[model samples]
Target chain A: MKLRTAFFLNTNKMKFITLIVIITFNTILHSQSQTGLVQYGHKQSMGMGAPIGIDYNANLIFDNENSLYTFAKDSLEGGHIRESVYIEKDKDNFFVNSKITNKLGFQYYVDKENKKLLSRDIGFNYVKEEIPTINWEISDEKKDIGSFECLKASTEFRGRTYTAWFTTSIPLPYGPWKLQGLPGLILEAYDTNKEIYFYFKSIKYPMDSKIKIQKPNSESENKEWITFSEYKKTLINKHKKAIENGRMLIEGFDSADTAEDKYTMGNSYIEIFDNE
Target chain B: MKKILFILLCSFVSFGFTNERIEPISENESAEITLPVKVETYNFPYENGTITLTIFDNGICEQGTVTGTLSTHCDDDGIADYVWSGTICREHIDALIMQFNASC
Candidate 1:
């Protein structure tokens, strides 16, 4: 009876120690933050005659398995109006809204452990997508961007084929926007059509700052997330309703003209959709 | 009379469409603080041709102008290392302009 009681006590103590060990390991793995900055030059357009070239700075922050990528301009510029238009009474004025490079204000969070991505859309709604696997075929070709020697890699993502140059010197396995899955940090990437380009200007490692990446609640009573395909369908339906209700009408133009103008002069998503 | 009106209308349209660059100038203004924040005006020849009244922290611009014309159309597309905006509150910009004008 004494031996049995001692054995039982030892079993209970072992279970308690196991639980504590698991909890401590989880805390250590999840509580650390690594933040870095990347400067990028972009050339994008509304599928018009020529694309507009622009520049941007982005912040890449990550923990052990999750990473948050956001535009540094939107995070720092605070509240600044982009553009506004005032109509003249009975005057035929042609005005185009400023072409936005990253209109979605997308905060892309990658969960490597789950093989998924959480993106904050334009309407402040979140969308979770399976990370697109762009079976990258790396080539032995190499070049130097700034001080780091970079290797060339190519992959087809969504509807566009992209060529990317990454450096193993950083070994961050991250890049601006949605381009990732490389073994190293991507310094430059451009699609075949050159409609979009991301050239690296500078990089900061082990940044002297702490960035908190808070994931939006998806299970709350009011918060929700929709799949990318479902969101596209909803967007099309919303546009159809807006057209039917004449809410998207120009003062002296028909719905067809407005739609054409929207497609021609207005901006499009970086990932071109077949629905368009 | 119709010809005159047409020419006048043409001139008015030209004035409305032409790009204009306006810069505010000041010389005698001085502040007592170690670092002074003053208002400076700049007009850029970029996409939208924006005119901005900037609140410049002189502490950062000891080497003359840091980003005068660069931050015209928002800081994201500019050449400046820092991001700033020309869309600051008009009242706040006006107050800075007034203070700079009055300081000595």
Candidate 2:
């Protein structure tokens, strides 16, 4: 007891903050206030134009007022595919593997009651922004997916036109990977170009005690939250660097004509264009 | 990448003729130069595999697990030797070089 007290005294403020987080975490786990959790299979095209796209698992965990959109556990391990362009001294034909390297490391935390959206991107930068509105064209076309009747809805989001199937039976607007504002729980989604696909895999009506929805960096003092403008600026700078590196790699290659192709290069991203 | 790895392995597995040079000297000089060298391979490691490096007195440095091997001079500078690390999509690409206890 004396040793524990000494340790706490040595790092008083940090320990106190950690203690609060621990208590809150335990309470969230044990309490009956949580709602549901769902898993989705996310498919993305390999950049080098390989037919077999990489697959990932994403999760949507929700309570009464908040939801967390993030990657599922162990999903990213086998999902990574890197494109390596090897240029030989004499051989001009360079082999470009159908390696898709675009993956989002951003986690979205939505505050429904407060109408605020918080996200942590690139593992460190915490950004707060208003939720972008998606103008969905809901149609009466209906289909049954896993015993749930779903309606077809299409929306042009960020540069991709996506068709989503949401079931009104659940009466929840939660969905995977920021595809939200639905009339009900989204079960499946796919882009028009077939480059991106998301499908509902499983769900727990009441989230398991072991399952957790992470609180944003605002809960911790070590992280200082930034605005979306700041986050966008940082991303633009990173994007420029990546383009520069790609150009350098392509400069000496004989097959320079195909240098800008996404399959031979990994410059393509999920958001083809994002004005906001 | 595959061809490079195959060629490296082939060169290393050559019967007795590698692309390395070593000239024999007199018996008296050889006797004075003979010394016991011990090396233990430690993996600093990555999620995909281990980042292991083992160096010899004859300027032969072999990297295990991942793909690397270069002829370089060395001395055992312990675990905290010059760390060369980068990221393979936000995750660390941890690489370490183990310096040997002998000079080339």
Q: Which one is best on lDDT?
A: 2
Please provide, for model 2 over B1-104, each residue's C-alpha lDDT reduced to its tens digit, 9 standing for 90 to 100.
53345334323423122222234557766533333323223333434543333322222222211221111112111011111111111100111111211101
DockQ scores of the candidates: 0.02, 0.02
What range of 10 consecutive residues in model 1 chain A has the weakest lDDT sum?
Answer: A249-258
Estimate TM-scores for all models. Answer: 0.53, 0.55
DockQ of 2: 0.02
Candidate 2 lDDT over residue span A1-276, tens digit each: 999998878799788899999999988665644578877777655232222354666778887667887752333445544332222112221221122222444478888877778876542577887877778899999998877899999999877788999998777777777778888888898877556778788877765564556656655637788897786666555445444433332222222122342321122345543542
Candidate 2's C-alpha lDDT?
A: 0.51
TM-score of 1: 0.53
Across residues A1-276, which tens digit of lDDT does each residue of candidate 1 receive? 999999999999999999999999887544442455666665553232233333345556664466666652454334333431211111221222222233324477888888888877544557788987778999999999989899999998866778999988767677767788898888898886565677777776556665566654556427678998876665455434323222111111111111222331112345655564
Shift in Å, residue A108, candidate 1 = 0.3
